[model samples]
Target: MTKTTPQTNRRIVLASRPTGAPTADNFRLEEVAVPALEEGQLLLRGQWLSLDPYMRGRMSDAPSYAPPVEIGGVMTGGVVSRVEASRHPEFKEGDLVMAYTGWQEYAVSDGTGVNKLPAGFAHPSHALGVLGMPGYTAYAGLIDIGQPRPGETVVVAAATGAVGSLVGQIAKLRGCHVVGIAGGAQKCEAAVKELGFDACIDHRAADFPEQLKAACPRGIDVYFENVGGAVLDAVFPLLNIHARVPVCGLIAHYNGGTLATDSAAILRRTLTQRMRVQGFIIFDYYVNRPDLHAAFQQEVGNWLKQGKLHYREDVVQGLENAPEAFMGLLQGKNFGKLVVKLD
Candidate 1:
């Protein structure tokens, strides 16, 4: 049996930097002191933590917009935690909030970066995925950048993923025909049946390009770029004139940065087709509009209740299995948004 101390917080830390794909060995779990809560701070016990694609970037000391996670530091992520004890008046015991608490069972908050969540919200875990960062990303990028016209075709890969799933559903609501590209047959079925996508093509098929071409009859008006390798290559030739491309994520090439080369013909097509390709981070938009969060909280909540918006989570039972679940994420093993559960 394991011993526990009231002052000790269990956490997962970066044990090693991954060369390509992060392995179970990359994470190290240890018990450490519960950090001292300052006068305007609180101690939080994590409930649900989000594991996303961006965590891969933090594992290495790469020159990027966000700082890298040090070898010994906690793995960075979003957390839905309950306030255990608060010295801060803004929060009291049992308060829940959305925060960047990383991979830890307990965390210290000065109430600086943490956003207070609703008091008795059911499915608080939804705050970390849908109705949260990923949902916001799909909202901003698709509406602002994609701008799909009614009757136009919108294509997206990783269609069953957190962001991509919302993107497709939103496109359908906009009167645009949506075709999703996912890995396996199961994900494709879920995309078409449950998510209400017009059709879904499996990227793992022997002739993906052939299937995608068959799916998008009018060519793609809005291409929500998620997995950027062979899938991007297939979609490149199908983009119609004046197509809008929202560069959201590149999960396929994320394991190892596969900087692909665009052919001269494709470059020529960009000029000939007049494609508008834009890449954005959601932080820029949501920062100016706190109301967006409130709006999404209402809209996504209603959709879930009305059975319009559906989400699937690949939840792991223990903190010990988190590393394996996370590692499987980069490879498309997890069927939905990956989250770790700890009692």
Candidate 2:
């Protein structure tokens, strides 16, 4: 009997689920055999794997927009990878592409839903950050529903994060007075001074609600909800009549706890105030996205080139750290977009 030699493939799988905040023990790293390429498929060596708050929804056993990750299964994520071998006609060895390759050092894909990255792109890892899913989410959610306008007051929480940062910048471009809410002093400073937000308040402050209220004395015309627990509480009373809210993420509640019961009252206020509030998953808007996505990418890409749109990345080296790094995301420990690098 012949034994097959295992090729290099490292994976991080769900070890166990947390009742609340996830910990290192929730993920188990294991060695697996590199997959053989099949027809129209390519073997990818992951370059960068994005760690996002949405992954927390997948970890829980409760129902959500996406299914929960089964215990002992590999955690799912978007990845930037280089083609190591290809049986597909369109891809070749060394071609860099973006895919949903999850938390692994190796993956195999049949080229469907893959974007061939532009050659000489300075940061291939960017496919998981500013130019990628998070960016698109901010673009679509804010535009299709929120419709941020000139001279309006825009308030967004998680202001230093991937989606929230772009939301602030795009709103600023519309001539809005943008106020950002972040977790700490350092992040608040960067949100205002670095990203050009009109003002930023630290949610960690002892009197955060008052500070946020002070920053938006004119009341909020648009509320981009990113961290939707206490921060929502602060922003609620400040929402102006006919305000628009585009609900994208609720990172503060990702740990499986419900917010205070009074949160339901905000919907009543929405009805009485005639506000337009909508919750959305970006992927839902992709079918009608070409026009907006192109416009957003062009403008945002230019801003990036001109040193206007700023992005911060919390990079942790190796696939091995994905579990711990993801734990940090749920706890707001990540200062910006989090990505894990693997050779």
Candidate 3:
């Protein structure tokens, strides 16, 4: 099938660094002429763009595991695209691929760091969610770092989200009692009913800490840390001896929030409990452990196929709506893995 080359590429670029939460003003949309592909290059048309909490950190110039998105540059993100045209030997036109092509309608790539989607893959969008980065984050963080054992109590924050949902369900499959902490009652319900969490607490409730403690009568053996402000404050006291805390993200503090003041107490507890509080970036695993990624693809992919795992996406339509959707994501407004379906 012949594909028509796109003349213009529409992209969202960073206009200015955000102080607190990002607003629509921080992003500027531009339509520019598509550049011709050179040798060993591919022209990609983005179909789906992922919006994640980590992008909030990239919006700031603060010291982080990854570099900040430069001013006037396209906001950094992973995209699932189709190869509209290719001069690259390894890729061909009409192949679906996953790449870090940012928030754009079209991109030119030299095929570096690009992974072709398996032919006839049922859900291509899953490459951006369950079968992709978020899925790996949950798998590695929970299995490798958290190391949940049978009958242990595991608590996951942001429980209905892409990572947390998988974390909780995986814990259940491993024979652990999984408790989830989510924002509202509806999400809390979904965490238990849809995601198969043993119990889910609403962090927005006034008695949230009490409820979390009540839910975990055996004490938390593993805490998958995602939203780490008030949730951390509540979970800290209930951690069992030798508990493992895999700190994947701190979304509550992403928008220039205050640091926790009770560091001394935290250290004291860590010392007494012999807790393993480790932080990890998924990129490190990708570089060091390709085997784990393969194992994840096999195991999780099977679970999905057998209808043992669940995944969700809160999709937004159009490139023009991405900024507003992203802003909503940081505020816990999105119900699941947020993605933009580019028009």
Candidate 4:
């Protein structure tokens, strides 16, 4: 295959920090000449870009685990790219790789953080979803932190989403009764039917809390905390003694929301119940436990092949539409793992 090199690279950069929810105005698209690659470097043409809730935190200059994106820097993201050209000894042209190439059409890399996609991999985009970071996050957080046992009840918020879907499925495989909390009738239905969750409650219902309680007759032994705010409020009272809560994300509170005011009550309940609530970032596990990643790849990869796991992607076409699609994601408009297919 003859790979064509583009002269110009189009990228989306942070125009300004957002006050509340991010808008299209917060991102600016600009085209610039692709830089010439030096020796020991490679040029990448992006095929897919991942848009996740964590990106919202990076857009702000607030204190966080990772540094915020600079005013004029390309918005940070993970990309699956094809090596259009390479002068590096380790990598070759025509190789498919996963890299932190941000929101750009083209990138130059020294291969520091690039991982070559395994040959004959059926889906390259799955490297950004189920078989990648999100899948690992679901597996490690639930199995290691949540530690669900047989016949226990597990409740997952954002049930049909990228991480939550896998969390629920993995819990079921461990012999637990899985209940999911999702928005709207359609998502709730899919959670139960498609994802094999025992029961799914629609959070938009007026009696959502009541429905969640009804679904979990044995009380929640493991609560996979994906959406905070109202969902957290509903799950808090139902946590059984010695319940485990793996806090993977707080998507509801990501867009400058008010802090929960009932901390005293929460602490009191935690004391009485002897609950275990731990927050985790996937990057930590990558650094400290390479073995877990290997296990995840083997176990989850096998489950996927055996038709025991389900994955979904809410793909948006064109780089120009990424800003609007991202804004919609914050509002719960995206139905699955959000990714952009670069033109």
Candidate 5:
């Protein structure tokens, strides 16, 4: 069924750059008239908006891989949206697409980077989570950089989260023993039981480091680094000789906290153990890689359909509540892949 276009578009724009943790004051909600679509452009109504940890880096003007969102710009993000009006030949009015339309209710795209969703694609929001960027991050980092061998022990922080959950599961598929580090007892339990992690330790516990060490008796062969602060400190000593580390996100220090990095100690470990610590952005693998996307979707998608993989989403309703939900994400209040459902 074709959808009617709304006259007004509701958007959450960056009011001011965040100094530390982003607050509600840093965002401004505005209702503006939707502009007329040009020829070859399609009007999109956002259905699901992804809120990820990487967006935290974009909030600041720090020297990073991608440029920061300028003041008054719509907060940048990926969205699963429906085409309401299409002048583009490739898309129809009722077609679903995965677009980088940010945090706005409606947007117009000329099919530059938009991907038409597969017909009967189950769980469209999975495009923003497990079957999308987060899933690719986990797969590329673990397989290419991590190089997990059979019988190796792999550990990942944020075990119940979007990327971490898949990291652990894929490691298991590669015949490695997978251990997870999560925030609370409940998340830890879910990680072990639901996600098929061999063991999961609670990071909030008093002796978190000790608990992690105990779980991985053979030492960590690969450490998927999502949280950098205390978790890295704990994982450091447990890393076996020649262990690989794929640094993805640092959610622990994203809201203004020092990463516990002793240059001398890190160098000492690097020299003595011959360990490899590599930082990678998923976009690097994704760019100009139709082969990678096909391989990932075929392998991971099959596993998901076969019940070998699991995903969770912490969805908050409405575009207006995005600021509040995003703030809670920085504080570890989100249970899984955090997304805002624009109603």
Candidate 6:
């Protein structure tokens, strides 16, 4: 039986675009009546909402791979939601699904891109973090582009973060020495002690570059680039000949103005070292290849079941807090994968 739909739905919409770091003023909360579902539509009650660095790009009206979220529009996000009413053949009431339902408490989907949760799923929220996009980003970028080898040194920035955490773990599984770069002591410690990295360098330290160089004495074989800026500059000299770099997120420069890298130096090094710096957008993998998705789910799912993988979520309560929580993510204030719990 289907549950009765709520008369009004709470939502957070983009109030304004920010010049640099976004603030609470950039968002607006509103209440509106939930629209009646059509014959092929299903009502989704959002449960867990993901807050990622990529959302920063979506908030802006800049040119990018995906279109920016329009002003007065609901902020874009991946959500774990429950079906309240289903007029669609492939869905039913009480079904939990993963969908891009944005920052709203309720949504109507025509079943496009909605995925049913696996039976006996222990943590549905993991779908927004480790088991979902972030995990796949780490897997696809590291394995396919980075191509880490046994006994080689692999480095990743934002060490305790959603993607970097998985990148380090998978590198470790491949028998590679993993070095992680994080903002502070706590995150660095978590990366080394909990996430099992060979060494975790504190990017906040005065001698961060020196520390990173020391950690990777053999030079970096594969550099999983997440947070760019000074971190990329530091990793540049340490990159080994013919090293592979999987360019993923650039969170460090996402909020503030772009950080200028020495192009001349990069060109000289590119020629002399023959390093492969390939930029990848996770969406490409989702579209170009489907097998990679299946491989990641099966392998990472098995690892999770066997206690070979660990995940952490920094869950913020309430839909109203989404704006503030998102701001904190850009500041690196959230300890792990930032998620919002509506219920």
Clashing pairs in 1: none
* TM-score for all models, in order of appearance: 0.93, 0.94, 0.97, 0.98, 0.97, 0.98
Check candidate 3 and list the clashing pairs: none
- Give the lDDT ranking, best first: 3, 4, 6, 5, 2, 1
lDDT of 5 by residue, 261-329 (tens): 587898899778899999999999998666877889889999999988988899999999999998988
lDDT, each prediction: 0.85, 0.86, 0.93, 0.92, 0.91, 0.92
The CA lDDT at 82 in model 6 is: 94
Q: Listing every candidate in turn, what is its Cα RMSD in Å to the true structure after a full C-alpha superposition?
A: 2.9, 2.8, 1.3, 1.4, 1.6, 1.2
- Global CA lDDT of candidate 5, please? 0.91
Off by over 4 Å in 4: 1-4, 259-261
lDDT of 3 by residue, 1-343 (tens): 4656679999999999988888888999999999888999999999999998999988889898899999999999999999999999999988999999999999999999899998768988999999999999999999899999999999999898989999999999999999999989999999989999999999999999999999999999999999888899999999999999999999988886654649998899999999999999998889898999999999999999999998989999999999999998888888989999985
Deviation from native of the Cα of residue 209 in model 6, angstroms = 0.8
Cα lDDT of model 4 by residue, 1-343, tens digit: 3755579999999999998899888999999999887999999999999988899999999999999999999999999999989989999888999999999999999999999998777889999999999999999999999999999999998888889999999999999999999889999999999999999999999999899999999999999998888899999999999999999999989986653539998899889999999999999999999999999999998999899998889999989999999998888888889899995
Cα lDDT tens digits, model 1, 1-343, are: 1423258888999999988888888899999888666688888889998888888888988796689999899999898988888889889887888899989888888887888876556688888877789888887778879988889999988888888899999889889999999989999999999899999999899999999999999999999987788888889989999999888888877686553446676678888999998887777777776776567667776777777887888788777777888888888887777888866
- Poorest 10 consecutive residues by lDDT, candidate 4: 252-261
Q: Each model's number of backbone clashes?
A: 0, 0, 0, 0, 0, 0
lDDT of 1 at 321: 77
Alpha-carbon error at 269 in model 6, in Å?
1.0
Candidate 2 weakest lDDT stretch, 10 residues: 1-10
lDDT of 6 by residue, 73-179 (tens): 99999999999899999999899999998999999999999999999888999998888999999999999999999999999998888999999999999999999
- Candidate 5 — which residues are off by over 4 angstroms? 1-4
Q: What lDDT would candidate 3 get against the real structure?
A: 0.93
